[model samples]
Target: MKIAVFFVGEVRDAGFNASALAGADVATAEGLAEISIISGVRYDQDAIRARLAEVVPEVDGLVFIGGQGNITTPEIAAQYPGKKFAIVQGQKTGPNLASYDVLQEDSAFLAGALAARLTQSGTVGHLSGHRVPPGLKGRAAFVAGARQANPDIQVLTGFCGTQDDRTVTKAWAAAEISAGADIIFTMLNDARSGAIEACREGRARQIGNAMDWVEVDPEVFIASAIARIDLGVKGAIKDMVAGIIPDTPVHLGLAQGDFASLSMGGDVLDVHKEYIAKIAQDIRNGTCTVPNTYDGPEFQP
Candidate 1:
């Protein structure tokens, strides 16, 4: 069997790159399957349709790489009807499609709790690539968790509109810092580097996304919400190969080891360790559940 993986943008983004590599690696290691990758900067109907027209017929399965792009567009869905496709990070349901909805909001909530406990200024910041549902969901969950940890905490929010624009992200980070946000949680893809730079210059702490950032910037990065896309893609492909397609969305969270926050080698303050531990335990024990989208109550922390 062979699989074709489609990414919404350049392969440099850690989240998307990680998923593609994970899928390819799994296919290679499994010996019975082969995998290929196709990347595009645009998710427009025409672009996606053209790419799929060129790549879909040659592969036994299709994998949509992680990003904010919508995989359920009518054109793409109709073209690949009854063909096995695995979508990551976005929700789209079909008879032959399996969606891997990573529970990023839960990880964001833990990061928020840590920010509230660690910040000396009692103010936290959240920076997103865009105002899309995924980014907004993570931001809202983070703010809610921050308030749960510190009721009086002030949460600042901003967006860069695009993940590749670092200059705008730097400006937003500086502005958030100027507003007294001492700890910043960043969800931008490649734009996160700019936010990290701003945090370094402004002497503020940061929470990283997709993967840990302690090694990237030891002094400023306290912790990160790491997404295990490799495992997710492998699992999806394996299921398809085994003829075990799922009827509902495949939800992966802390409980399923799809996401985690590593404090090892982090710059987290001692005061925040207990709170982080508590939240992690609650997430594991099913005592705390965070929403994936804004369909829940408005988070005001």
Candidate 2:
């Protein structure tokens, strides 16, 4: 089977795109499918649609790598019903298309809980690049977790326009710190450097997403929401290779092994780690519900 792994940003982003691309590389090496990577498309809708149109006709299957695919992938898949389509971290699905989500929100919730417990200023912040569904869900879960941990804790959250714009993210992170946020939860890609710089200069701690940022920088990162995008990509590719297009999106979360987790740095207290563990169990046991939508006002930096 000939399958194309598609992305809307730089595949070497060292964050979301990098994780998904790693999975595609493994699948290709294992001979699961004849994989072709189609990257370098901008975040613009027209660009994504154009790239999809150009590539979908030539491949037996196309696996889009992010929630950006929730829109254009379905439209393109409908145009080519004979071809298999899947979206990792996506919500939409059709007969010929499937979506697989690695529940980052589960770990985002734990980050919020940790932030609530760790913040000395009684305020925390959230920053993400796009206003996509997965990012929105993560923000909502973070806010919900913070609220659950401490109802009076303040959460200043915003969605910056660009994921890779270091200047924009740096300014945004600084603004959140200026607004009294001591711990910021960031869901970004290559733009993460800006947030790290802001945190370091401002003496504020951070929580990261998609990969284990705590492992990368223990001093700046207090915790990391680990979401295995690579696993989702591999699962979608395996399904596509086996010609199994499920009717529903494949959902993987904390209960599904280490697909999603909240990794804490050495600075985290033992008691707080136990608290986060209990919360994770509650989410797995359905006792705690992570809100998917945040209707509250957005903090504009």
Say which candidate scores most in TM-score: 2
Per-candidate alpha-carbon RMSD to the true structure: 3.1, 0.9
> Estimated TM-score per prediction?
0.89, 0.98
Predicted model with the maximum lDDT: 2
Using alpha carbons, what is the TM-score of model 2? 0.98
Locate the minimum summed-lDDT window of 10 residues in model 1.
292-301
> Where does candidate 2 have its weakest 10-residue lDDT segment?
249-258
Q: Report, for all candidates in order, the number of backbone clashes.
A: 0, 0
lDDT for predicted candidate 2 compared with the true structure: 0.93
What's the true lDDT of residue 88 in model 2? 96
The residue-level lDDT of candidate 1 at 189 comes to 72
Per residue, candidate 1 scores C-alpha lDDT tens digits across 88-187 of 6657666777677677787788888888887888888888875656678788888888888899988886666767677888888888888889988888
Over all chains combined, what TM-score does candidate 1 have?
0.89
Per-residue lDDT, model 2, residue 173, is 99
